[model samples]
Target: MTLSRRHLIAAAPLLGLTAPAVAQDAPLRFAVGPFQPTAGDTRRAYEPFFVHLAASLGRPYRLTVTADWAGIAVALATEQLDGAWMGPWGLGTR
Candidate 1:
């Protein structure tokens, strides 16, 4: 589920579409699958991009490093996450 910078760039349009519907003051909750060796490493690796995203969108964001696909899936299904950074192949689009 690790994302290259390219993947991040490609997701910008998707974010643009969804970010606006989020409440203006609520922190945007984002999740990531177990992309790195550890959660800390994953968070650190993606922090800069997420920071830039939040700042550029003028919104606060909370990043969560999920332990596995199921963890991220649950977060999204339950609305705990607004978006996620994942490999496109990891989950098929409906």
Candidate 2:
């Protein structure tokens, strides 16, 4: 999703909740659904946020652009992704 610097700053604290357990050398995996019109658009919007986050946290952050919401969910459930940005409704009832 396209996140402004303000949004990222606000989310930093919440995202940090999971950061402690991750090793400093390990890359934090972050996934984003096809929220923007195109993958390139999404990446362009989010790339800077991840870069800033990585710098702020002093750890590398990997951004995975998923084609669909289901892929994001599966990745999270399987622990392939440490975090995700998607619509609340994207998460279906189990």
Candidate 3:
């Protein structure tokens, strides 16, 4: 069963079409800065917000908040997270 050149060419676009759908399945990483009084405080304030966002997006969202502002920057730079909610200073640096 050899694959003809025409068959290969026909399949190429199908493969490309599947990529976007696969990418859409990926989970979103939400980096929540230490923008609150504490980890507990931040979680309490934003946990519901994130749940709603994730539901609306039809994707999972993992909340990550560093102990300090520097940690949040490192996570963002490394691409460990996709986006973040930051305070005034956090937004300024990014």
| Best candidate according to TM-score | 1
Query: On residues 1-94, what C-alpha lDDT tens digit does candidate 1 reach at each position?
Result: 6665456446655654253544367887777778789999998998787687666556788988888888777777776777777766543111
Prediction 3 global C-alpha lDDT: 0.60
Question: Could you tell me every candidate's TM-score relative to the true structure?
Answer: 0.71, 0.69, 0.63
User: How would you encode candidate 2's per-residue C-alpha lDDT over 1-94 as one tens digit per residue?
Assistant: 6565556546654654243534457887887778789998999887786687666656777898889988887877777776776656532211
Error of 2 at 42 (Å): 0.7
Evaluate residue 1 in candidate 2 and report its C-alpha lDDT on the 0 to 100 scale. Answer: 65
Per-candidate RMSD, Å: 5.7, 5.6, 13.1
**Candidate 3 C-alpha lDDT tens digits along 3-90:** 5445533543332213343247677677676757889898888778657655654567688767776776787677676556676643
Query: Candidate 3 at 40: error in angstroms?
Result: 1.2
Which of the predicted structures, 1 or 3, would earn the higher lDDT when compared with the native? 1
lDDT of model 3 at position 65: 67
The global C-alpha lDDT for each of the candidates, from Candidate 1 onward, is: 0.68, 0.67, 0.60
Candidate 1 vs candidate 3: the TM-score winner is 1
Looking at model 1, which ten-residue stretch has the lowest summed lDDT? 14-23
Q: Which structure is stronger by TM-score: 1 or 2?
A: 1
Q: For candidate 2, what is the lDDT?
A: 0.67
